[model samples]
Every structure is written in structure tokens, then in C-alpha cells.
Target: MEQEKDTKSNGDDVSRLEKYKEELIAIHHKSQETFEQQLSYISAGSLALSIGFVKDIVKDIDCAGYRPLLGIGWVLMVITLLLNLVSHLLAVKFYRKSISEIHRNEFVSSKSDTRFDKITWLNWTCVGTLVLGILLIIIFVNHNL
Candidate 1:
């Protein structure tokens, strides 16, 4: 009878809906944990590493409150910190959509390859400048002394 057929279809729909609902909850739970991990743990590591590097560099510069060398090191540390924050933010935003192949492809498309190249170039430039500045400071101080 048509009534029997209708009842069977309804039961199927109910079971399917329940299954999907459970799957969705699991995906959301995982996404939330991943986001929190990046924002908290990963970012914390970057913060500590950057600050520690600068702190070590400036260990003996307490007397020169306005030392340009220390300032440059601090600037590099801050730049590195900001880059890590941005990367973590991107990873968090993509964590949920990361389930879909299409979404993953979209994420890959959105990020610029050239941007990473430029960052590399800038890093090298900054390092070169730092070395030059240190050499200049040593030369000038040595001559003066």
C-alpha cells in the first residue's frame, strides 16, 4: 500500500538526518580544537622564540637605552612575530573548510607563491643590512677608541 511505502521513506530520511547531524558535530568539534591550538600553542612558540632571540642579543645593552642595534633586532623580531600570527590565522580559517577538496584547492589558490618569495628576499635583505650596520658600528667605535 502507498501508506506503507510512505512510512518506509520517512524512516529512511530520519536515519539519514541523524547520521549527518552526528558527522557535522564531529567536524565542528575538530575544527574548533585545531583553531584553538594554532591561536594558542603555535603562536605562543613564535612569541617566545622571537622575544628570546632579541633578549639574548640585548643582554649586555642595558646601558645603551637607545641602542640602534638593539632596536633593529627588536624590529626583526616583531616582523617575524607578525608573520607567524598571520600564518596561524590563515591555518585556523582553513581548518573547517579543509575537509573539502574544493575548499583546499581554493585555499591554495588564494595564497600567493610570489609573496613567499618576496618574504624570503626581504629576510635576506634585512640580515644583510644588520651585518652591515654591525660592521659600521664596530669600525666607527674602533676608530674612535
Candidate 2:
């Protein structure tokens, strides 16, 4: 009777452990999916905003002649900004998700480590795009005046 009781307890523990693992996996997958959805939404929004901003820049000018490059500059800037936003949203989302799952998942650390590249690259892209945009606007305005 004593042996039977021990065996039953051990089996219960094994079953519980497996259940916990399965739960953790499900949680991790759900968390990852949420992040991915947000990433897609953000990417789409950024692209739309960039396109609109560029369209505004090149729409019309008071200058005697149309500045061809004004439009192009805005275009480049907008594209860069959108790309940077994409990188940033994805990187940050992935990092946060990984941190949240660190306790249950060993792979979180590896995923977190890879986000640095996205961060740095995104930073540069945003900076370059903004500068280009400002320069282009100035050029267009000066020429129009």
C-alpha cells in the first residue's frame, strides 16, 4: 500500500509538470502573436503617414517654377522614416514580449539580444530621413520665394 501511494503521487507530479509546460508554450505563442499583429498595424500606419507627409510637401508651391527635387527629397525622407518606424516597432515589441516570457521560456534571451541591431539601424534611418525632409522643404521654399 505504501509503494502504491508513492507511485500515485509521482505520477500526479509528472502530469502536473507536463501541463505546466504546455500552458507556458501556449502563453508564449499567444504573446508572440499579439506582438506580431501590433507590428503589422504599426508598419501600415507609418507607411501611410509617410506617404501623406510627402504628398503635402510636393503638392504646391508659391515659387515661380516648380521645384522637381522638393518632391523627391520629401519622398526619400518619408520612406526612410517609415522604414525606421517599422524596425523600431518590431524591435521594441519583440523585446518586451521576450522579457515578459523570460521566466517561462529560455529562448527569450536570444530573441532579446537580436533587437539591438534593429534599434541602432532604426535610429539612423529616422535621423537621416528627418534631416533630408527639412533640407528639401527649405530648398523648395527658398526657390519659390
Candidate 3:
């Protein structure tokens, strides 16, 4: 009777392990997609920043009254870039963690992928800052003109 009970428990464990493997594969694909999406955001943000900077410099608008505003705008943009970088790094970190959990046979489907929520907030903050910076730059340039 004890042997029968042991065999049944082993079968259950094997079935559970198989389910975990299937779930882990899906989680891996999702994590890869998330990482790729984050990289895209970083790349796009870089291009926008570069173009905006070039345009601003080409205009060569110099006004003493708006100098402070221009300075603040530049600072905000720099911060935005830094935050984007941090968010990108966070994506990598989450991917590594997910992989590690899977290897340890401790992966839980419910707890696997939501770590990127913080990255979403960070991305939004980056966008907000970039927009504010552009607005300030526009206001300063227009005022000077």
C-alpha cells in the first residue's frame, strides 16, 4: 500500500514538472518580447533627443531673459535620457531574474512577468519629462524670436 502511495506521488510530481516547463517556455518568450520593446523605446528616445538638440542649436537663439528656462529644459532632457537608460537596464534585470527562477524550478506563472510594471512607469516618466523639455525649449525660442 505504501509503495502504491509513493508511485502516485511521483506521478503527480512529474506532471507538475511538465506543466512548469510549458509555462516557463511561454514566460521566456514574453520576457524576450518585453526586453525588445524596452530597447526600442530607448532607441527612439535617443533619436528624438538628437534631432531636437540639433534643431535647437541651429536656431542659435540667445536671450538673457529666457536663459534660465533654456537651462532648465536642457537639465530635464538629460534626466529623461538617464531615466530611459535605467528603465532599459531594469528590463534586463527582470529577464535574468525570470530565467534564474525557471532554472531553480520555482517559477510561478502568476508571479513571473509583472516585474516590468516599474519599467512602464519609468518609461512614462521619461516621456513626460521629454515633452516638458520640448515645450520649454519651444517657449524659450519663441520668446527670444
Q: Pick the TM-score winner.
A: 3
lDDT of each: 0.51, 0.62, 0.72
What's every prediction's RMSD, in angstroms?
12.1, 9.9, 7.4
TM-score of each: 0.39, 0.47, 0.58
Model 1, residue 7: distance off in Å is 1.7
| Segments in model 1 whose C-alpha atoms lie over 4 Å from true places | 57-145
lDDT string, candidate 3, 3-75, tens digits: 9999999999999999999999799768756754664565456446644654675355443347666777777
Sort by TM-score, best first.
3, 2, 1
List candidate 3 segments past 4 Å from native: 1-63
Give the alpha carbon lDDT tens digit for every residue of 5-111 in model 1.
99999999999999999999799668644644443443344346534644564345444344564455445444544554554455444444444635456545344
- Candidate 2 structure lDDT: 0.62
Using alpha carbons, what is the TM-score of model 2? 0.47
